[model samples]
Target: MQGNKSEHTIQKEIQLALSKHKCSVFRTNVGKVKTIDHRWFDTGLPQGFPDLMGYRWVDNQIFFIEVKSQTGKSRPDQLIFHEFLQSHNVIHGIARNVKDALMIVDGGLCGFGYD
Candidate 1:
């Protein structure tokens, strides 16, 4: 649907913005691999792994970002991962768009742009 496409577009924008940050930022892409039985399976990264994981040197903090569309929902694994991050004392959250991602990056004070 139109919403899904928009969501992905915004995700790409967020990725680009993250890449431009002065701090270390990396995005995750889960790919499918062949199973021992010869069938393709989604098994590279752990289930619910965040879309982006990186470290911010300024605050010496590790941040995990799960980018989603404005109307997108997180998977079960993602929720578990969020909880795990919290329990482990790591900073993590779901970002619906570039602005949200910016907030995660520097509390929206760094003026991260999507363009």
Candidate 2:
């Protein structure tokens, strides 16, 4: 939230948080980020990526997250994925902080197109 974060940076935060709970985190590769960076056929072509992917040991549930600063421009691809996640009931969002990330997991985010 305070600094610029690449997908890798978001992934690291997730990794650290998951570690505290002894949960395993899955990080997205640069290639994956580049390839699916957004929704290409949303009445447009998809081409974006998710910042982080992981399964919570406590819930045995998987999450797909896209992090962002509290305020700024959101990538076009992120908007596409937001819709995708909403319809699919997967997790996704523009989180500003580690607490924001946790909220995504605890169902703190709703009606924003994420599970």
In terms of TM-score, the best-performing candidate is 1
lDDT of 1 by residue, 8-91 (tens): 576677778877875577778776878899999875788888878777777767777877776677777777767677667666
* Candidate 2 residue-wise lDDT at 70: 44
For model 2, state the Cα shift of residue 54 in Å.
Answer: 0.5
Q: lDDT (0-100) at residue 83 of candidate 1?
A: 69
6: Cα error in model 1, Å: 3.5
Ten residues in sequence with the least summed lDDT for candidate 2: 39-48
Candidate 2 root-mean-square deviation in Å = 6.6
lDDT of 1: 0.69
List the pairs of residues colliding in candidate 1. none
- Residue-level lDDT of model 2, residues 13-111, one tens digit each, is 766886576456665643322236574323222455666667677777777666655444566766666777777777556555676667777663532
Instruction: Give candidates' CA RMSD values in order.
Output: 5.8, 6.6
Give each model's clash number: 0, 15
Note the Cα lDDT for every prediction shown.
0.69, 0.60
Cα TM-score per model:
0.72, 0.65
